[model samples]
Target: MTTLTVFYIGLFYIAAIIFFGGLAYRIYEYSRTPAPLNIPTTPAPTTAGGVVVRMAREVVLFESLFKSNKWIWVFGWLFHVGMAVVLLRHFRYFQEPVWFWVEFIQPYGKYASFAMVAGLAGLWARRFMVDRVRYISTPSDHLMLALLLGIALSGMMMTFVAHTDIVALKAFALGLLTFDWHPLPADPVLLAHLTLVAVLMIIFPVSKLLHAPGIFFSPSRNQVDNPRDRRHIAPWAQALERDNA
Candidate 1:
């Protein structure tokens, strides 16, 4: 393998390790953390089954966000749903025989990039145009958006402007999965897109992007508002009560 190939292989391996390992650790911490209050958001579900339905609406419909800000919610939902489809389409690269659904979605996923980019542009514009959002925006927030925009634009360029060796690209991805290192096409646009992807994966665990997983652990979202029926006590509080008794 050439030096470039070796570097990419190593880079991908490291990114995978960091991404998976970091997510695992973060999830473990979230699971272990105590929520001592029954503080589900208002109009909350009182039952476990009701909570599931509520969460489903929140995840799929962005119901709360829609009620709060229709424009932001529209853009945010479009971006998230587009990203999900795009990710599903990418399964072909890693699979020996891509799933039927993934293959079927290729056309939609191919076009979904436009929605993703448009939504991203809208969100980025908010940071600059909305004084409240702009006031709280940090350097890292803009940097993250730039990284995503770069990845999306470079990918679109490869798809629409410059032709990339996608066959070779799939081979390279599968090779990594199988402990073999295939020479990656050093197409500048492709390289730029992939480098940003790797960086995103590496930083995801520590970044605000973790809100994706952390949402599941949120007390207000996940908790059942049944304090009247059941007393809530944290683990430490339980121990203290035992000692006092």
Candidate 2:
């Protein structure tokens, strides 16, 4: 293997490890954190089943975001859905025989890049255009958007402009899965795309992007509105009560 191939291979391995390991650790921390109050938002679910449905709506439809701000929700939903389709499309590169649905979405995913970029651009613009949003926005927030925009733009360039050797790229992706090394395509666009993806993965656990998982642990979202029906005792509180008894 050439030095370039070795460098990319090592870079990806390190990136994958950091991404998965850090995310897992962060999720574990989230699970262990205490929710001491029944703080579900108004008009929230009262039962576990209702909570599930509510969470589904929040996750898939961005229900809370939709209710809070329609414009932001529109852009956020477009970016999320488009990014999901693009990710699903990438399964073809890793699987030897891609699933039927994955094969079918190729055309949609090819064009979804446009939606992704447009949504990102709108969201980024909001940081500058909206006074309240701009006041609260940090440099890291802007950097994250820039990183995602870079990844999406580079990928579109590879797909619609300067095409790379996708076959070799697929081989490289599969090889990463099986420990069998393959030479990574050294196309500048491809390299830029992959590097940005790796960077995103590595920083995801520490970044604001962690809201993806953190939402599930949110007391305001996940809790049932039943503090009056049944006492809302945290696990630690329960243990203290037991010791007192």
Candidate 3:
């Protein structure tokens, strides 16, 4: 048990360091890379309302996914919603006796976990079954999906099928948060589930799953389409321009 605990703790730190270090390097490289010399020649919105509508549709409704393909949009939507619910359910882990609301939502949480696992599986299948998705899919993309599916499946199993000592798990979690190591008697299934979850967290900042944050960095989403008419500049960009000038 001690050896396994040490191994997983070591794996967690190694993965976290590599993932964060790689992400920082990637961002630095991207920052140094020159922007496209050619301006985008896509048709511009003709009216203010049109521009507002376009931005609203893309940001709120994921219009780009719909435009890409309706099925893609549907799968993406389901996967995102399921993920959100599952994340909310995880708050139970930090609380004692769980909260009333969490207890109230326990049934839905189970359903949400099941839905998330199914959604990830469906998305993975869609990636292969659809030609467009298949054409664009990379191994890393598939791995990310597979990892999420594995984590969700393992977590659901822990919640519903496998009996876990929640008290022990909670004690270990609190100990870790307090920077004290209190190793619990190791359950292999719980350990595996936790290891997978830790792996996901470590990889998240580096993966395309980073689009969770990367959406804010997207020029199309973050930058005004009418940059010519409006002097729109990111604060950091403006600072750089001032320093250079």
Top-scoring candidate (lDDT): 2
**Highest TM-score: which candidate?**
1
Candidate 2, 1-245: lDDT as tens digits: 88989999989999999999999999999998888778898788889999999999999999889989988998999999999999888989999889999999999999998889989999999999999999999999999999999999999998899899999999999999999999998898899899999999999888898998999999888988888898877899999989999
Give the residue spans of candidate 2 off by over 4 A: 242-245
Estimate candidate 3's RMSD in Å: 4.9
Give each model's clash number.
0, 0, 0
Q: Give the clashing residue pairs of candidate 1, or none.
A: none
TM-score of 1: 0.97
Shift of residue 9 alpha carbon in model 3, Å: 3.8
State the lDDT of candidate 1 residue by residue for 29-79, as single tens digits: 999999877788877888999888888888888988999998899889888
The residue-level lDDT of candidate 2 at 171 comes to 93
TM-score of each: 0.97, 0.96, 0.73
Residue pairs whose backbone atoms clash in candidate 2: none
State the displacement of the C-alpha of residue 177, model 1, in Å, after optimal TM-score superposition.
0.6
lDDT of each: 0.90, 0.92, 0.70
